[model samples]
Target: MRRSSDLSPEIAEEAAWWRDAVFYQVYVRSFADSNGDGVGDLEGIRSRLGYLELLGVDALWLTPFYRSPMADHGYDVADPRDVDPLFGDLAAFDRLVADAHEHNIRVTVDLVPNHSSDLHEWFQEALHAGPGSMERARYVFREGRGFDGSQPPNNWTSVFGGPAWTRVPDGQWYLHLFAPEQPDLNWEHPEVRADLEQTLRFWLDRGVDGFRIDVAHGMAKPEGLPDMDIRPQAPGVLSDDVHDPRFDNDGVHEIHRMIRKVLDGYPGTMAVGEIWVKDDERFAAYVRPDELHLGFNFRLVQAGFDADAVRSAIEHSLAAVAPTGTPATWTLSNHDVVRHVTRYGGGAPGEQRARAMTLVELALPGVIYLYNGEELGLPNVELPDWALQDPTWERSGHTERGRDGCRVPIPWEGTSPPFGFSTAVNTWLPQPNEWDHLTAEAQLEDPGSMLSLYREALEHRKSNAGFAGEELEWYGAPAGCFAFRRKGGGLICALNTSGASVPLPPGKVLLSSGPMDGDQLPPDTAVWLV
Candidate 1:
């Protein structure tokens, strides 16, 4: 409930800093660009340290900056131990970590263990080393099932689109659960396990506080790579209710167990899995004491602005992790999904709903992650078709517009498209002209702006003694409204999604998402009372 300044860095250093840490996910490629390359880099993040420190976040969960060909925007890591030249060199990364710690902000990086870029040395060698070779054993390489081995080995589909199997020139096929350029690894192989261990040590040696494991539900595939029993979902959606044999296999926990053992060697470091698991008990397994420290529960993100849906997501998210004595990791938007503002309704209504949801998310117990531009109330950009670069764009034959909408570069200081994001002619993804008012510079001066609300809310969350406690006590509300109080803290957070304003509970008002009606909490508004 307190920041490093109030809580003491020594205590965070000695204890599990992640327990109550609020992480701001830095989608590095779209955060800022220091070299005018049109793409963000490590140095850009370092330059913004003052801004982040001012914002009062405990840690930065950065997306991959590893050596890559940009096939899947750095998720397709080519060299696990090296920084991509597109970003700065190893020295830049080292400096970012050191400077961040100086700002009392720990840094956590993304680790893609489920797969690697097709250009990775291991995969490149596997492509030409011939079938049955030791090099091929590092990845999932199998013979095609057709008579002449021309067809794919199985009916499994890629998360991006089409067949998951990509045929090699030698009649053998390899598995890539994502794009063809990113091949899945054979987690059963000792070499693959050792290589992941090496990557972990390499980054930890450079002082990274932790990792946000990419596709943590993957890595271990079922034996024989069995065909999934369910129908296909819309492109890029894996809500877990779809029982796909391609992921969440029983074997995956063993990989997490191995990861935990490695991370345990580095005290105060943690691992939170990007787990897309749905079933309660199955999802809980990932966060067992011996496995991952936390797992991302996307229910909140998937839940729309409905009161019932939101409540169910909170209840389920909390219940799932209770068995393991782990806190639920909650988030409203991410690099992979549409920005929540647009999802809530879009336009002024969307902005109001998004702000209300933020109060709900921040008030909840446990660790919460905020996307880079969320504090400013940035909505998704509807990019032109030619501007799309996500693999799913081409893989799905342009049938689905991928996640580029939410990945637009954030507005820092200007009133234009680039918005001080880059000196280049354009950003990697274009920002909307309407975002001029939402720029960090503009909102910084406005006491009523979205950024100010976030700043004030975070300040209260840190300074107010009422933000303490691990669970909430629900209170009955009007048909379209809901209320809850943090158990020990006695802080009441009430939201009114109803048609009319409601009487406020008795307490000193701490903050509200919007203007209240005298003593009443208005529709689409949330209030924190202590």
Candidate 2:
């Protein structure tokens, strides 16, 4: 494969650029705000191109920026073909793509094929055209089951809260695994398939390198829309083990195959799915040669900061993709979950654990998607009750706090809330006051800071040529420690998950997540050796 710096169309079409690539996930709404609307936009991302380039990421996976009602923070796409006015026009998107390519960075946007906004033209037409109309066939619209059609068609629950079926004024119930405003599409319809294919080509033609498909596992519902027999888990959690009839249906693979056919025509362009299949063999199906190029395995994210748990998570993730010849995608935090720093344990301990896991994720084969503020050791904000914006907040009867904490605008500069995120005092989500010390600018000057660790680590990974291949050789370690060597790279990555320090492996120290305790690797720390 050619270097990203000299990547030409010929090279792009022929090479697997995604493998071993480091992608940064940019939640556009919270990234930056050039127009000072208190919400990030395309131009804000453009202005930060230099910063991203300096960070040494190979590509960027952007969350949805399409025309949306913001019901699900851009996931409720009203028009897949156009940029939402909230994030600038089509020209701004084109410019962002151009600028990204100029910086030798690939750009991948989110594609939400599982559903569309209720305000979408197709859905609007369906609402106006009445029952049994052709337009209604585009989405999942069925009659309620009760005598007077008062009950839902099925007992399925929404991922957010309550019933998955939303009743319309016409006495019809529509399927929405997520929020009601985001109605699930009838993937069985030929028009839906054709339209999504068109949408894929539209962005690909505009120079987007690939797509991170949203809720990719939910595209194909079961034949009868059967009632799931399992008890519900916590809100917003979908485990394949739960046997939720709403997800991982056999028909989904056909949809992926169709998507892959379009992507294959564009060659090197990738289609990464947000697949949550827990069964290894079933998960492997999504990444087969004819389907998605990559399927994110969230086991690592869900694992605790303990040796056995972390090791098992890694082993499981690798095993799932090993059969398909696809590299496992690694990530710790994203727009949908609580930040890893907080999840690890929070405070100084959480930061240390999060920093250590970063090394583990990067050392692994395949792609690493770093959420926008993770490199800064940003913790999830404790937003005021009124500041919550996730639909789950209201949908869950105000019981669950939802994901608004993690979606807070990133701290770029300044010493207060909004930081450098916006010129306006009111940001869409409030930034925590404690984040002043964690701002990129504040951390840039400190060699010991989280941002510095990421920059240095990325630079080393790129220049050393030790991360070129996908082979890991595991080494037995002390009870609370684990180590793995990159095959033929003459490099080793070791971690100490125990409270007590452990002996450093035999090699020259390349990098460490924290200061070593003499010859010992400290607890909650990771180190790279050469």
For each candidate, give its TM-score against the true structure. 0.97, 0.97
The list of candidate 1 runs beyond 4 A from truth reads 1-13, 234-236
How many clashes show up per model?
0, 0
The stretch of ten residues in a row with the least summed lDDT in candidate 1 is: 1-10
lDDT of 2: 0.89
> lDDT of model 1 at residue 222?
88
- Per-residue C-alpha lDDT of model 1 across residues 1-530, encoded as one tens digit per residue: 12234445565566477987899999999999999989999999999999999888999999999999999999999998999999999999999999999999999999999999999998989878999999999999999887888878889888888899998888899999999999999999999999999999889878898999999998888889887765757443555542788888989989999999888777778999998877888899999999999999998988878777888899999999999899998999999988888898888999999999999998999998999999999888889998999888899899988899999998998878789999987888888888889999999989999899888888888888898899889998887788999998999999888878999888878899999899999999899988
Could you tell me the lDDT of residue 40 within candidate 1?
97
